[model samples]
Target: MDIRFIPQAEIDKQLYNSCVHFATNGSLYGYDWYLNATAKEWDLLVEGDNYVSAMPLPRTTNWIGRTQLTQPVLVPDLAVYSVKPLSPKRIQAFWDAVPEEYRGGGLTVEPASVPKNAGRFEVTTAVGDALFLNKSYEEITDDFPSTYYEQLARAERADLLPVPALKPEAYADFWLSVHGKSVDNEWKYHAMQRLMYQVLHRSWGNAAGIQTRDGQLLAVSFNVYSHNRIFPLFRAESKAGGDAGAMTLLNDTLLRSHANRSLKIASEALYQRSR
Candidate 1:
């Protein structure tokens, strides 16, 4: 049960590999490329000699000089990633392993991973639900309500074609135009949008979109690919797109198209939830 801490500044291939192997969603968000690209340093928790179990500690400081730990974007909640669910006692040990300095700090944890008898840490409801794609296209299409079905049908008739090879700038620019005013006017938000587009150029994922027959862009999404899962990051649609049901068509098409492959699309709550 030996535990070692690796500062975010010193993370390397070895540590990143360990993270990818041990973390549940490692393949998507636990790689050096992702960590470096995001430019947000995250400390690592390694167990035993080779990182048998681990978790990331994403760190940041506020303008008021108060340092806080927060979850990175486009990632599900962090977990004490391990070979199996940690027992109540081990979960407590994991919590204790956090540098005493961070013990009192707030961090996000997967609700399921937090043992019932663990610590007295506060747990808040997650802001969003993630859609884990497991069902087939036929299954998905059949289940969607009439509203979605009607949207898809109209979007197609509107002559808005799917742009599977959508460009990154197109997606970023569109989002900024529509939603940037609502967010912090900081450079970081803008920079992250650029970085997301840059990453889209890689084989890891793609920038998907939909456009009218006249080539007017209506919607775009940057889907990050890793470990056979596709997370469509920042999917957005224009007024025209919304009216035409461009998103409904795009998403439904993806689900059906990738049904043969082992690929699954994880969304931030596209369907209903029980928890």
Candidate 2:
């Protein structure tokens, strides 16, 4: 139950990263490189010398210019990650150890992490979706309606082909040019750009897209992969391409590329939207 905060610089990256990578519920977002790219600043709360349990406290400047522990963009869960399953009380200890200044700020925990006890902190719930890639692509799609294949066929007829390796910089520029104005907040846009670059630069993941044979770019998506999971993080599509079912084709390629790998797609909403 002994938990203490370690400043970002003072923590042992090797030990901490080892714990996260090997933990039962480890995620790419919990890794050091991920935090460096997304969080403006961060610290850690550790439960034991071997890092038996740990939580990442990502910090950022709020709209009002005050420092707060905030969730990074596109990051879903940021709670205690432990080598073994944690009891509600042990999880609560890590939450309590978070510095008071970051109290009002929020982050998310995996559903399995919460077990009916939250001593003094307020808790809110949100729903997310994931797709399990446990079977062959055909078997996985067998449950889908025939219209889904029709959509992909339309994209193929339109001459849209999958670009399995899209340059990160190109994807970022494409995303910003398309969705930047809609963001309304400049900081969020820049933060997203930084995250995309760092993640791709480190080769932690890759960006893929659908484009015409004549080389007209249409739809693009960024996916981060670990040993057993893939996170379909950000995506943008041109109006014409979307109408031609470019997104559907892009997602189909993604599914086919990693089919039968037993990987999990963190956000299945992307696939659902394409349909």
Candidate 3:
């Protein structure tokens, strides 16, 4: 088999369609979102009689490649590999085909390694009702003030809630407030940029914004959509208010509003601590 690298945009649509079909029918979780996010950055690896494609999905400076072999092969143990509802045999076969060189590197194929599922939690409304099924927090705390939830719930009930949205222009200001106090890194900015583009392209759900009572743009969140799942890509708030809790408030409102749709909160493992 010859390994050939090509841009994702150049890959045959039929092959992509096949991957999608396999993902959906074969119980691949996050595959749809991964494919859609990295569709334009994929490289196809072909053999004499068969072909496969590798697509890279980047978050900040880190990236993970999703390999699609022509035949069902052993899946790699990448941090993002999620094949639910798929037969154990098929999943094992997929993992078996993963290149040995790719096996134990920092690269991950398992869903847990992606850092997306981190900080995911099921947060309830102040009324102690299960408002959101799964939620991700920026930090994990053993004793987060319970009052925060109550305040958030109150905010929602009063219709003073924040909506999850992505505003690219506010990226710099938001990051400075969130991470700058501790360490100044540009990774968040890059991630935000990619997220903004994804939002602009509607790669995620409809993006929206949160405002202060004074009408200040406080934060933005990316609402990622995949059939029934809705993941918030990036959620941040201004630092002007001490313990603003705008993000928490926004999440509460979103969950309450989206309860009828059964929207599941999804994220990489890195954000799971807060959940």
* Each model's Cα RMSD: 3.7, 2.8, 10.2
> What TM-score would every model get versus the actual structure?
0.81, 0.86, 0.55
lDDT of each: 0.63, 0.74, 0.41
lDDT-wise, the better of 2 and 3 is: 2
Model 3 over residues 1-275: C-alpha lDDT tens digits? 23344354565655543443344322122243344433323233322222232223322112465333221111122221222333444333333334432323233343322332212211111111112343343222224566766656544554443544435656545655665653324645554565456556755555555666666665556665654556565556656422455556655555556654544544331122122
- Residue-level lDDT tens digits of model 1 in 1-275: 78788887765668556656656544455555565555366787777766767766676666766554566655545666666556666556676676744533455565544645434344332345444456666765565567777787788789788885655555667776656565443443465565675565566667778888888778777777665677676667888888887877777666766765666554332432110
In model 3, the worst 10-residue window by lDDT is: 121-130
Ranking 1 against 3 by TM-score, winner: 1
What local lDDT score does residue 210 receive in model 2, on the 0 to 100 scale?
87
Q: Write the per-residue lDDT of candidate 2 for residues 1-275, one digit (tens) a residue.
A: 77989999988999898888888878777888778866748999998888888888887776787666677665667657898677777777777677876646666667655536554444444357778788898887888877777888788789877775666567766776667565443555566577777776777777888888888888887887774788777678888777788988888888888888878787423365335
Q: Considering every candidate listed, which one attains the maximal lDDT?
A: 2
Compute the lDDT for candidate 2.
0.74
Worst 10 residues of 2 by lDDT: 118-127
1 or 3, which is superior by lDDT? 1
Model 1 residue 144 lDDT? 57
